[model samples]
Target: MRAQRGLILLLLLLAVFCSTAVSLKCYHCLDPVVSSCNMNSTCSPTQDTCLYAVSGMQVYQQCWKRSDCHTEVIMNLLEVAKVKFRCCQFNLCNKSEGSLGKTALLGTTVLVAILNLCFLSHL
Candidate 1:
């Protein structure tokens, strides 16, 4: 009986963990300066990279894939080399709040609390 209960609890935790682990995220900004701080948001799965680009005085932060990154755009007649990009795979690896990771943790914590309350009520 105890083992069965443990298994159920394990399953619950697993469900929580699985529910929120796969989303991609990155920072977004336009016309930002050095003091500018961008916020991260969920990105499409096809976006395999986080891009930070600077042209003249403008800044753009975006989520992108290598293919997208390679097929570069020459904005403002700037040379392709003048535009820069940085890509990463980890969640919120850019200069934004890593909310996806935090959200997953919060979801698991809430699930644990709800389960605890349910068990206690049964007692």
Candidate 2:
């Protein structure tokens, strides 16, 4: 009986962590900056990924389609001579915020697991 309860709690916690609250989001910047960009925008449903690019002193980050995540496509679209690019598919996953979201999620997951274990202990 306790094992069943523990398994149920674990499944519930997994569902909570796996669900998406909203559409994808990406940091939005098209200017020269020395570090991470602070601005962001929620992506349209069609925009399935976040794009991050750096060219010389300038940085670019925005919503992008996963199909168009190639260097040549992004370069042509952004009109850059040479640029480095990264693409990802999660909230602010262009990493403008530097994994704070992941850290928060990890912390929340740990807290929930602890509480669930405590609750199960009494059952």
Candidate 3:
């Protein structure tokens, strides 16, 4: 029946849409300046987090996983103060470029959802 065909089509669409191709990116900088972002990393799928570290006068930004970014550690180094590590979930949130680009992520999500729906309707 047509209904059966539709169901089969729906399943095929789901299979294609469900496959995730996530790529995480993070910016690196010694200070919080967008232009000063000297590095960037394309994190593996497991590393679903981003970390920003600051200590005394040094700052670093990179991608990390949930368990990788532990709480801050206060240590003494001669006359230097302890380092502080901050974690954020948003894409490029820890970047010196700021979080204004977050809206782009929303668009991507919506596109995926729309693709899924389109597949279902055709089925």
Best candidate (score: TM-score): 2
Candidates' lDDT values, in order? 0.60, 0.78, 0.61
Taking all chains together, the TM-score of candidate 1 against the true structure is 0.48
User: Would you list the rank order by lDDT, best first?
Assistant: 2, 3, 1
Tens digits of per-residue lDDT, candidate 1, 13-120, equal 677555534566767766546545557777776766666666656666677665665525534333545665455554555553334457557757986897786576
Candidate 3 residue-wise lDDT, 38-110, digit = tens? 5777778887767777665666677777665654321232122566776666556675435435645775788
- Which pairs clash inside model 3? 6-123
- Number of clashing residue pairs in every model? 0, 0, 1
TM-score of each predicted structure versus truth = 0.48, 0.64, 0.48
Candidate 3 ranges beyond 4 A from true positions = 1-21, 30-35, 72-81, 97-123
Instruction: Identify the candidate with maximal lDDT.
Output: 2
